[model samples]
Target: MHRCTLSKEKLAAQPGGEWTHSVSAGFLKTLGCLELLSVVGLILPAVLDIAPVMVPVTAVCWVLLLTGAMITRGRLGQVKLVAGDAAYFAIAVFVAYGRFVIEPFSS
Candidate 1:
């Protein structure tokens, strides 16, 4: 979420920003909003003891998101970025599996 927010800021500050020029500004904002919602889905449902199943679902979504990022970075020939995305994907997978089958949150 923080990174998405920063990317939005970068896009706003410089419409033709080098790093962001590859993607549309509107798409960046949408991505940021989606990330914010994913965070909420990650925390609120479980914390409030309402629809706790959403926690693992959100984690799975994160895995998909990070996987897409890894693929994109790989295609861009950004090996370093792909490594970081892979790490994030692994963590998300761990959390998803843990919540879904290991120590699931009680509803």
Candidate 2:
């Protein structure tokens, strides 16, 4: 939610939105939307028991998003910026695997 709010503020052309400065406003907004939706998917479907399959799928999507962010940060030579994304990627991967195999949500 923190990240999504910041990206949304960037859409308003506000200052201090450096987190998304590397990308265009439209791209940032789209990414924010995806992130927000994934957040919803992470919680709502499982809680509601409706299409609970979405939780792991959303985790996979987050893994992909974090992978892209890490690659982009690498290309920019921003080694320091890569850590967060890498950490997020690890967690997302774990969620994907755990949810799919160990404790998948039931419909």
**Root-mean-square deviation of every model:** 3.6, 3.6
Error of 1 at 76 (Å): 1.1
Instruction: Determine which window of 10 residues in candidate 2 has minimal summed lDDT.
Output: 10-19
Candidate 2 lDDT, 20-81, residue by residue in tens? 65567667767877888989988898888889899999999999888887887787676766
Q: Positional deviation of 87 in candidate 2, in angstroms?
A: 1.0
Cα lDDT of model 2 overall? 0.77
Off by over 4 Å in 1: 1-19
What TM-scores do the predictions have?
A: 0.78, 0.78
| After superposition, candidate 2 runs with Cα above 4 Å error | 1-22
